[model samples]
Every structure is written in C-alpha cells, then in structure tokens.
Target: MRVLVTGGAGFIGSNFALRARERRPEWQLTVIDAMTYAANRASLEPVLTTGEVALVEGNIADAALVDGLVADHDVVVHFAAESHNDNSLDSPWPFVESNVVGTFTLLEAIRRHGKRLHHISTDEVYGDLELDDPARFTEQTPVNPSSPYSATKASADLLVRAWIRSFGIEATVSNCSNNYGPRQHVEKFIPRQITGILQGVRPKLYGSGLNVRDWIHVDDHNDAVIAILEQGRLGETYLIGADGERNNLEIVRMLLELMGKPADWFDHVDDRPGHDLRYAIDSTKLRRETDWQPRYGDLHAGLAQTIDWYRTNESWWREAKVAAERTYERLGR
Candidate 1:
C-alpha cells in the first residue's frame, strides 16, 4: 500500500509516520508538509535516511500539488492544520486557509481520484463540557467550536461529511482528544511547561489552572488511526481517547513532581479569551468497533517518558523554544 500523510513533519503526524514504518514495513510512504514554523524536518530524518519514507514540502491547500499527490497514493491521512488556540486568536486567517481550504483541496482530489482518506480532527470542535458535567463528548455531540482554530477544524470536518454524502467519497473522520509525546512544538502547554522547567524558568499556567483536557500519548493515537484506516466503515466518525482526563493545574503539579521541582514552582498567567472550561472524549465506538486499546494507560508513566525525550533531545527543540518563549512573553502568557 502507498500511503500519503499530510503534515507529516509536525508532532502527531511525524510520530504516525514513524509508527507506520515500524508496523507496516511493506507500505510505501510519502509525507507532504508545509514545513511551517510548527513543522520540523528532523522529525522524519530517520525514515528518510532508510528510504522507507519520502518527504515533500508543500502546503495542502495547493490544489495542483495535492491533486498530483492524491492521485499517486492509495490513501491520504490528513493531519495538516494551524492547531494552536492562542495563535488562532492572534491571527485567524492562517487557520482558515490551512484547515478549511486545505481539506477542501484534498476532498476534491480524493473525489476525482477515488482514493481512500482518513481525516484527522480534534475534540475541541465539539466545544467544551461544563466542569461539573459528567458527560463526555460522544460521536453524536454537535460541533460548537469555541476558537478560530477549532472553528476551522469543524468546518473541515463538515466539508468531509458533505463530500462523503454528496459526492460519494471514500473517507472516514476521527476526532481525537489532546495528544502528548515527543516531537511536539514547545509552544504547546505540556512541552512549554516541561522545557521551561529544564531551562530554569518557572512553568506558566493559564487563569486559575482549572481548565480540563483529555490527554493521550501520540503513539496510542496513531495506533487507533491505523485501526480505523484498516477496519472502519466509510462515512463514519469515531472519537479517539485514552480516558486520561486531567486539568491544567493537576498537569503542572505532575510535571513539577516528575522533574523534582516543588509543586508551587509554576506561575498563573492570564487566561485565554473565551477559553473552554473543559474537554473530555468518549471513545466507546472506536474501541468496540476496532478492538483497539491504548498502551499508555497511566498518565504519570507517559509523562515521565515524555520528559526524558525532551531532556535527551534538547537540540531538536532548542531553537524553536527560544522563539516560542518570546511569543509567550509578548502575550504575557
């Protein structure tokens, strides 16, 4: 099988490529990424050297490029997007172009070529559940995206469904919860705190640090994607999660403890505008339908492993960290 992975230079996409190589050695893989500030070519260097995977630097919104790439590959796993909420609030246009326009381009190509596709999306598109609510986001949850980033993602998801129903495209969509592991940009919450502590800087938390997020390891997330690609029904949506629900404050405390710092070593910063209070995902369909299970069931063990990756590969994140911190400073976050 020939597989084309979009945004393969970024965090989750890069890990997906690595895992795909290990799990499906016979498949020919190609990655087309925009190589934006959030993307790192080094993440795919290992597989590139072995000639198991080829990297193509391009934006998914380029119809000419996307049409050609989609025509050649047997399947397209789309992970391209401007995903940071803060950046979306600062500038919404890029998110719309990358998420909505890009998906439309791919949908057209996939429609013309009759190629299979698995659209990757986020649970934030379902908006946030109340902090006190016991309900988790299910497949039936209506999309109520809070930020520009998620709004564009929700738009992309809707586009896919429209094409699937109207044009009869072969595709599936999976909305996953928060993913944490290696290769993540330092600008994100988990890496910001981890790398901050490593640099002798105090970790920064937003608002009261009570906002909740469901965390899953990138490896587990990719594993589930593989299952859905292989076994899932077309025109279906699955929610992917590991049942690892944690609030911002609890996560900061966990990181501090893991890094041998005091629990109170972090500072509270201004909360994001219109920040969602909490997000939780229910993956009952994904589990029952694919027989998929997560390996990093313990959040503490997963975080410890993540911390070690950052410590051992400081070179990979050093330059990016400098720019990311500067942006945060400008925002006073």
Candidate 2:
C-alpha cells in the first residue's frame, strides 16, 4: 500500500508517519509539506532513515503538485494547514487559503486521481460548547465554528463532504481534540509556557484561563489516524481523542509544577475575541470499531513527558521560534 501524507513534518503528522510505517512495513510513504514554521525538518529527520519515506516541499494548495502526488497513492491523509487561533486572529486570509482552499485542492486532486482520502479535522470546527456536557462530540454534531482557524477547518470539512457526494471521491474526516507532545511549535500553549518559564518571562493567560480543551498525545493521535486510514468507513467521519480534558489554568499549573515555576508568575491578559469556552470529542466509534487505544492515557505523565521533550530539545525549539517570527512579521497585524 502506498500512501501520501500532507503536512507530514508537523507535530502530529510526523508522529503519524513514523507510527504508520511501523504498522505497515510494506507500505511506501510520501510526505508533502510546505515546511511552515510549525513544521520542522528536524522532527521528520528520524522518519527519513528508511528509503520508503520521501519528503516533498510544496504547498498543498498547489493543484498541480497535489494532483501528481495523489494520482498514484492509494491513500491521502490531508493534514496540511495554517493552524493557530492567535495567528488566525491576526490574519485569517492565510488560514482560509491553507485550511479551506488547500483542502479543496486536495479533494479535487483525489477526485482527479480516484484515490481515497482521510481529511484530518479538529474539535474546534464544532465550535464552543454552548452547553457544557461530558459526552463526546458525535459525527452528527452541527458545525458552528467560532474562531477563524476553526471556521476554515469547518469549511474544509464541508468541502470533503461535497467531494464525496458530488464527485464520488472515497474519503472520511476525523475531528480530533487538542494535541500536545514533542515537536509542537513553541508558539502553542504548552511549549509557550515552558519557553516563557525558561526565559524568565511571565506566561500570559487569557481571561481566567478556564477555557477547556480535550488533550490527546501526539503518539496516541497517530495511532487513531492510522486506525482510521486502515479501517475507517467511507463517507463517514470519526472523532479521535484520549478523552483527556483540561482547562487553560489547570494546564498552566501543571506546566509550572513540572518546571518548578510559580502560578503567581502568570501575566493576566485580556481574553482574545471569541475564545471558545470548552472543546471535547466523543470517540466511542473509534474505540469500538477499530483496534485503537491511546498509550498516553495518563494526562499527568503525558504532560511531564512533553515537558521533558521540550527541556531536552531546547535548540530544536530555538530554531523553530526564529522561523515562526518570519510568518508573524508577514501577517503584520
């Protein structure tokens, strides 16, 4: 089986590629990435050991590039996107181009190539939990995205559905929870917290920092992605998560505890506009139908391991930070 993974150099996609290679030893893997600031080549270096995995540097929005790559692969996992709520707030055009237009481009390629696809989505696309509930987000949940990042993702999901319906393209979508672990760009919450602590900079907290997000380890998310790729039903969407839920303050406190930093060090900042209160997904379908389960089920241990990854790979992060600033300056908000 030959597979093409878009955004394979990013945090979750890299882990998924390595884990998928282990699962399907005979399969050939090709990873196409624009190598955005969030996607570090260092993260994908480990997977380059085998000649089976090829890394192509190109944006998924390029129809010609995507068409040529998808024509031969049996499966395409679409993960390439400009993902970040803060950055999205600063300038949403790039997010739309990557998340919405890029996804449409992939679906169009799949249609032209007659290949199956798995479009990776996020829980944020389902929008904020207007009414709080512990039960997971089912496929039937209505999409009402609040932020630009999520709204674009929701638009992509709609495109996936349209392709499956109109063009008869073989495809599925998986909306996952918050992903945390190694190789996550320092601009994110966990890495940002760690970096700020290390730099003696006070970590900023939006509002009361009570906004909740379902946490899933990168490795665990990789397992779920492979499960869907291998066993997921066509034209159906699935939710993948470890059922790990934690609010902002709780997560910040955990990070501080691991780094021996203090909660008092937090800088109370005004909340970002339209920040979601909570996000969680129900992966009951994933658990029962597929032989997929998360290894990092323990949030504390998972978070500690994540902290350790950042601690040990400080230089890796330093380079990533420098690269991300280039994108930030371009947005010029």
Candidate 3:
C-alpha cells in the first residue's frame, strides 16, 4: 500500500511516520512537509535513509502539488497545520492559509481521486471545560474554539464533515488531546520545560500555572489514528486520549523534582490572552470501537523518557531552542 503523510517532519507526524514504517515495512510511505520553523527534517532521517520513506518539501496549500500527491497514494494522513497557539496569536493569517485553505485543497484532491483520508485534529476545537466541570469533550461535543489555531481546525473539521455527507468522501477525523513525547517542538509545554532545565534556564509558567490539559503520549495518539484508518467506519469522528489529566503546576513541579531541582525553581509570567481554563477528552468511543489502548498511560514515566530524548539528542533541538527562546524572551512570555 502507498501512503501520503502530510506534515511528516513535524513532531506528531514524524512519530507517526516512524511507527508506521516499523509496523508496516511493506508499505510505501511518502511524507510531504512544509518544513516550517517547528519542523525538523532530522526526525525522519532513520526511515528516509533506509529508503522506506520519501520526503517532499512543499506547502499543502499548493493545490496542484496536493492533487498529484493524493492521486498516487491510496491513503492520505492529513497532519499538516499551523498548530502553535502562541504563533497563531502573533500571526493568524498563516493559520487560516495552512489549516483552512490547506485542508480544503487536500479534501478536494481526495474527493477527486476517491482516496481514503484520516484527518488529525485537536481537542481544543471543543474549546475548554471549566475547571470544576465534571464533563469531558467527546465526539458529540460542540465546537467552540477559542484560539485562531483551533478556529481554523474547527473549520477544517466542518469541511470534512460536509464533504463526507454531501459528496460521499471516505474519511475519518480524530481529535486528540495535548500530546507529549519525543520529537515535540521545544515551543510546546513539556519540551520547553524539559529543554529549559537541560540548558540551566529556569522554566517559565504562565499565569497561576493551574490551567489543566488532558495529555496523551504521541505513540498512543498515533496508534489510535492507525486504528481509525484500518477499522473506523466512514464519516465517523473519534476522540483520542489517555486518561492523563494534569494541571500546569503539577507538571512543572514534577519536572523539577525529576531533574533534581526545587518545585519553586520556575518563573511565572503573564498569561496569554483568552487562555482556556482546562481541556479534557472522552475517548470511550475510540477505545470501545477499536482494540486500541495506550501503553504509556503514566505521565511521569512518559515524561522521563521524553526528557531523556531531549538530553541525549541535543544537536537535534539545540538550534530550535535558541530561536524559540529568543522569540519567547521578546514576547516576555
């Protein structure tokens, strides 16, 4: 089988590509990445050098390119997007161009070729649950996105639904919770803290550091996506998450302890505008419908392994860290 993986150089996509290559050695994997600031080609070096993966550097918004790529592949795993919330706040146009327009381009290509598609999305599209609320975001949750990043994603999700119902496109969508594991950009929460401590820099926390996020290991998220691709019904949406929920304060304190530092070693900064209070997910549908379960359900153990990746692969993330920290410092974040 031939597969096209968009944004395969980015964190989660790269992890998916790596895992897919290992699991299905007979499959031909083609990766098309825009090579944005958050993307590193080095992440896919292993598979690329072995001739198991082909890398294409280009924008997903390029309709001509997307059309040709989609036509040749049997399955398209759409992971391309401008995903960082802070970056979207600074510049929303890229989010719209990459997330909305890009998704439309791919959907059109898939519609034309009658290819299967698996769209990867985020739980942020459901907005946030109040800290005290007992409810979690499910497949049925109404979308009330707060950030430009999520709004575009919500729009893309709607477009996919329309294509499926109106045009009979073969596709499935999975909205996963915040993912933390190897290959994550340093700009993300867990990696920023991990790389910060590694560089002898104090970790920075926003507001009271109590905002909650439902975390999932990247491998678990990829596994769920694979399950959906292989076994999910068409026109269905799945919420993918492990039952790992923790507030920012708890995560930071745990990281400090793991690195042999005091809990209060980090600095607190002003919060981002319109920062959601909390996000959680209900993945019962995904778990029950498919025989998929998360292996790294323990956040601490998962984090330890992630920290080790950043520590040992300094060359992979060092340059990105310098640039990301410079931007953060200028923004006073």
Candidate 4:
C-alpha cells in the first residue's frame, strides 16, 4: 500500500508514521507537513533516516501539491492542523486556514482522485459535558464547539461528511480524546506542566484545575485510527478513547508525585476563556466494530513512561520550551 500521511511531523501524526512503519513494513509511506511551530522533524528521524518514509515539507491547503500527492497515493491519513487551543484563541485566522481551508483542499483532492481518506479530528468538537454528567461523547454527538480551534475542526468534519454524501467520497472520520505522550508540544497541558517542573518552575494550573479531559496514549489513538482507516465502513464516524478520564488537578498531582515533588507544589493561574468543564468519550462502537483496544490503559504507568521520554530527550524539547515559557510568561498563563 502507498500511504500519504498529512501532518506527519507533529505529535500524534509523527507517532502514527513511526507506528505505521513498524506495523506495515511493506507499505510505502510519504509525509506532507507544513512544519509549523508544533511540528518537530526529529520525531520522524527514525523512519526518514531508514528511507522507510518520504517527507514533503508543504501545506495541505496547497491544492496543486495535495492533488498530485493524493493522486499517487492509495489513501490519505489527514492529521495536519493548527491544533493548539490557546494559539487558536490568541489568533483564529491560522486555525481557519489550516483546519477549515486545509481540509477542504484535501477533500477536493480525494474527490478528484477517488482516493480513500481518513480524517483525524478531536472530541472537543462535541463540546464539554457537565462534570457530574454520566454522558460521554459518542459518534452521534452533535457538534457544539465553544472555541475557535474546535469550531474550525468541527467545520472540517462537516465538510468531510458533506463530501462523503454529496460526492460519494470514500472517507471515515474519528474524533479522539486528549492525547499525551512523547513528541507532544510543550504548550499543551500535560507537557507544559511536565516541562515546567523540569525547568524549576512550579506547575501552573488554570482556575481550580477541576476541568476534566479524557486522555489516551498517542500509540493507542493512532492504533484506533489505523483500524478505522483499514476496516471501518465508509461515511462512518468513530469515537476513539481509552476511558482515561481525569481532572486537571489529578493529572498535576500525579505528575508532581511522579517527578518526586509534593502534590501541592503547583500554582494557580487565571483560567482560559470559555474553558470546557469536562470532556469524555464513549468509544464502544469503535471497539465493537474494529475489535480494537488500548494497550496503555493505565494512565499512571503511561504517564511515567512519557515522563521518561521527556527526561531523556531534553534536547528534543529544550529549544521549544524556552520560547513556549516566554510566551506563557507574557500571557501570564
């Protein structure tokens, strides 16, 4: 199989590329990434160095480039986007361009070439649930995006559904929960706190730190994506998660304890505007349909493993950390 992986240099996408190479050695892989601030090329060094994957530094919104790449590949796994919520809140134009316009570009290319497409999306598109609510987001959940980042992603998902129905495009979409693991940008919640502590800064929490997020290992999330791509029904949407729900406070405490610090060794900061109270995912359909499950179901163990990665690979995140901290300090976040 010849596969085109968009955003293959970013966190989940890079991990997808690495995992794909290991699982499908016979498949030829090509990556097209915009190489944004969140992307780290070094994450893909293993496959790139071995010639197992080819890299194309370009934007997915480049219609001409996308057309050519989609035509040659058997399928496209789209993971590219401006995905940071804080960044989106600060600047919304880039989110519109990269998430909405970019997905439209890819859909057009796929439609033109009659190629298969697997669109990666986030559960935030379904909005937040009450902290005490038992309901979790499902495939049928109506999009109620509250932020620019999620609104753009919701727009992109709607475009895919429209294409699948109106143009009969072969595509499937998966909305996943929060992902944490190596290669994740330090600006994100888990990494920001983890890297902050490593840099002698007390971890900062927004508001009361009661905001909840359903977490999943990057590997598990990618595995589910692969399953949806290979075996899922066309035009179907799958919710991917591992039941790893934890409030922000719990995660912070766990990180502090894991790093050998007191659980109360963190500071509180102003909350993000319109911060979602909680997000949960009900991935029953995905598991039943694909017979897939998460390998890293233990959040603590998974976090420990992730901490080890950042600890040993300080060089990978060091430069980005300085710039990210500066931005945070200026914003007082």
What tens digits encode model 2's per-residue C-alpha lDDT throughout 211-319? Answer: 9989999888888888887788899899988888888898888888877887676866778789888888888998888999999988999989988887788888986
Per-residue lDDT over 1-333 for candidate 1, one digit per residue giving the tens place of the 0 to 100 score: 999999999999999999999998988999999999999999999999988899998999999999999999999999999999999998999999999999999999999999999999999999999999999999999999999999999999999999999999999999999999999999999999999999999998899999999999999999999999998999999999999999999999999999999999988888999999999999999999997999999999999999999999999999999999899878877
Q: Which candidate do you rate higher for lDDT, 1 or 2?
A: 1
Q: lDDT for each of the candidates?
A: 0.96, 0.85, 0.94, 0.94
Let me know the TM-score candidate 1 reaches against the reference structure. 0.99
- Please write out the lDDT profile of model 4 over residues 81-182, one tens digit for every residue: 999888888889999999999999999999998999999999999999999999999998899999999999999999999999999999999999999999
Query: How do the residues 1-333 of candidate 3 rate in per-residue lDDT, one tens digit apiece?
Result: 899999999999999999998777777999999998989999999988988899999999999999999999999999999999999898899999999999999999999999999999999999999999999998999999999999999999999999999999999999999999999999999999999999898888999999999999999999888899888988999999999999999999989998999989999999999899999999999989999999998888998988889999999989999999898888779
Model 3: residues with Cα > 4 Å off, grouped in runs: none
* Per-model TM against the reference: 0.99, 0.93, 0.99, 0.99
- Give the top-scoring candidate (lDDT): 1
Error of 3 at 205 (Å): 0.7
Candidate that beats the other on TM-score, 2 or 3, i.e. the better one: 3
After TM-score superposition, the amount by which residue 90's alpha carbon in candidate 1 deviates from its true location, in angstroms, is 0.5
